[model samples]
Target: MQRNPISRRAEAIHPSAVAEMLAMGRKMEAEGIKVYRLVQGEPDFDVPENIREAAKRALDEGYTHYTPNQGMPILREAVADKLERVNRIKAKPESEIIITNGGTLGLYLAVMATVDPGDEVIVLAPYFGPYANMVSLAGGILVEIPMVKSGSHYSPDLDRLSEAVSPRTKVIMINTPSNPSGSVMTRAELLAIGEMACRHDLYIIADEVYERMVFDGHEHVSIASLSEEIKERTITVNSFSKTYAMTGMRLGYNVANPSITKAMSKIYQVSARCAAASTQIAGIEALRGPQTEVERMISRYAERRLMAYKRLSRIKGLHCCMPEGTFYYWLDMTSFGMNSWEIAKYILSEAHVLVTPGSYFGGAGDGFVRLSFATSEENLLAGIDALGDALSRLQPTSGRS
Candidate 1:
């Protein structure tokens, strides 16, 4: 069989697991089968009234033209102000920041600006699935460091991480209130990581997209906020998606040293041109406008996290850990002696519930599954009930219990 040659970078990537599962779930729904899908991290909430109204008003005033290649000055100023007030990151809007289409593009820009072919990017494992693809697409080697479990909580094996660094290591990419594991790195842990990166002369890509999606007793401290030295080496990316339920708005930004920011902006000018003008205005309202709606959304997610934890804990032989932040539950299905994708398949076939296989995150997650609590309470309850019932009927191959 003959086929067209594809670039090695593109050929190395796999289709997104979440997107694939969602498509399958939708197909089932079209066939009149009710599938309780907990596979996505997408917020099922409405965009706040103010943000929507702001976008509409911008359109009314004829804001359809392309914004500056870097970004609309007004929005960048607002973002810089919000970072100062909220994240404690002080950067000049003109030289240190550039607006992006979303966190996806923001991450890509950061990786492209610094990484070169054969350079290494250290990724904390059980990471968001796309991190691998992004690094590969940027022609960099992806290094994986799996977290150690400490009494249901996950923490980085700092010694192991330090051992992974090499002369080729260029970046240490991280996500707090992480996507698949939902483990929020403590302040002390973050400090230690910062020190390690400094000693290794590695750049930091801090993915703080879920900064506001935290639970009680869990605080999100941006690593770049630690010190001037660390801040200088860090590229911090964030978006209006999860916090404001404005995923469709396609507004995200990154702040870094002017050198890196300039490189990213040059790429943007040749690629996306600029973020949509009206969306940038909506982003302004998202940051500077009222935050009560943000608080309400966080409160709701906290409640849903509790509901999922309680239900998952009840399943026999299935170890469930409560997430401190984010809306995911990383379930340990290793007792059944099956890989994550196999377990996911079993549950979908027998239980009619959909979840992301942890292996999608990384090889370290082979025996785990990630379920989202980002759905409605009604759907959540049903999915949890089904999951519990299905797992209870199976016994661990190890026969330890």
Candidate 2:
């Protein structure tokens, strides 16, 4: 039998490790084995009651029809107000915002709208794995700039990042409260990156999906809010998934200047059409509703973060830095002799704990692994203990022991 040729674009992409491991863990659960899922960055909290009820109200009000390609006008207005009040970024609802199916798709639209064939997109290394695929889909080249690790912190190296930029560089993408590594870019770090983008005349694609998940006195600052010039050149993407535990809702949006938003709307209309109508209503409530639910969730995540980071750091052969934001622990396993992929598989099979191998993120991620703490306290304690035991039995790298 002959198989048809698939597109080179499709061939360039690989299945995401997070989704793949989540599936495998679920399969193990189906088989009656207790598998602790630590690979995916899904929040375990339930959606806030006000937001949930808003969706039901939308349905009851017969809001089931298709929404505007840009988004429901009301939601766009709500988002605009929230951006000004919360993020301190001014955006006109009519021309500067486009609602997306999710933050992931919003990133795709940003790339699709701005990236031309052979254009270079600079993504910070050890990034969320899907950014490469998103850039590839736009017929663009991906240029990775690995963040420099300084003791317990992961910080962007502006000089090196600027050096990586060339005439071919069209855009620079960054994530705050970053996925996989859980690093939150400081205001100083962001200003440096923003300066680089300005110097290079490159567009800025900012992903702040984990904006509300910051911990340990770290503040989440949207780069677009730094200045009017950068704001004009920036496209800010955010989601309700991580913040509100509304992953299934698929409600997210992007903010940019009018021309870019128009370009994104054209592609968005052809692809997603619009975020679910009811979901948009829910998003409106998420922005406008009371903050008690969000505050409660944040308090709980803070407790989990402290526990997970402390336990993971205590492992004999593993070294993990405390994440500034998000619920992921980035564990360095270079001493274990095995690369991230091999070690991840060993941990899953031996410890029954699922994790995302760092190499799946980038070459810089080769000896690292990412584990999510978005689970119960009991699971976090049990899973990290199992991981410690598994690592202790593995032989050290040559010359180490």
Candidate 3:
């Protein structure tokens, strides 16, 4: 039998670095290594009880059939209401929202609906890895604009961003409470970006999966809420995975203009049919039911963030900025005279701690490594202690002298 050739798109996509690290950690754990995993960006908590109950009730009621391509009307309306309540933006439920399998799928669908062949999509580095690969898959050029790092907070350079936009530029992808860095874009930054998007006639794909996970009195600003024009041009993507600890539920939705939503729904209908019915029901409950669970989870993550930051700061030659949001702490390893990949591998081998290499995000990430504080406090403290011991051995001469 002859093996079929893989498509170019399939060939273009690289296996996720986070997945690779997690797999390695699992192998080591299987072999009796006590691995402290800080790689994947998943919440350790269970799905909120109210959301789970909604899914259970749906199952018991036999609501297991396929729903509309755009999602259930109730879920869509609830999502729109959420946007209004949380972000202060008015969205039409029927024509402006498309439920997706996850925030990842929402991003892909947004790109597919907006990008033409050879069109340029501007992304800020260090971005989520899949953004570049997805652009390639959709036949769009991925134009990267590096973010300026000020300690731990990352701000998009508006001048550089303006330079990256040309007539061919179709979309700009923005991820706030960003993965790997946990940097939340300020309102002023969002306003600047919104102005650029309006001036350039470009669409903004705002990835707000970590909206509810902010810290230290920082606010998550939606670029779409900056103005009417920005709202018309922005596609805001959010998910239940991050906020509700419903990663396996595969439920998310996109808010955009009616035309864009229609186009995305067309792609969704052809490619995925619809998001899972039970998941959609769960999502509706997630939005409409009590939000106390989300607040509780955020509170716990905030505590973990503080614990991790304090521990990481004490390590010699390593610099960590207090993350304003999310469960990730980006550590600068430039002083270690090692690249992120080398540092990551060393930590795994010597300290039995798993982390994501920053280079996997982009070239700008070379001197950095990402640690997720999604585990229990005990594990977090233990992992930091192990890391401290490893770093001490590596830098003992300085103290000895």
**C-alpha RMSD between model 3 and the true structure:** 2.1
* lDDT agreement with native, every candidate: 0.90, 0.90, 0.89
lDDT of each residue in 1-401, candidate 1, tens digit only? 75989788888998988887788778888898899989988899999999999999999999999988888999999999999988899999999999999999999999999999999999998898998998998889999999998875689999999999999999999999898888899989888999999999999999999999877688999999999988989999998888998888898999999999999998888878899999999999998999999999899999998887787887877888888788899988899999988899888877889999889999988988999988999999999999888887788876433
Model 1, clash count?
A: 0
TM-score of 1: 0.97
Which portions of model 2 show Cα errors greater than 4 Å?
1-3, 398-401
Any runs in candidate 1 off by more than 4 Å, and if so which? 1-3, 399-401
lDDT for residue 120 in candidate 1, whole number 0-100: 99
Candidate 3: what lDDT? 0.89
lDDT of 2 by residue, 1-401 (tens): 76989889999887888887778788889989999888778888899999999999999999899999999999999999999988999999999999998999999999999999999999898898988888898899999988999977788878889789988999999999888788899999999989888888999999999999888788999999999889989999998899899999999999999999999999998888988899999999999989899898888889998988778777777778888898888888988878888999899888999999998888889988998888889988899999888888887674432
146 Cα displacement, candidate 2 (Å): 1.1
Lowest lDDT 10-mer window, candidate 1? 392-401
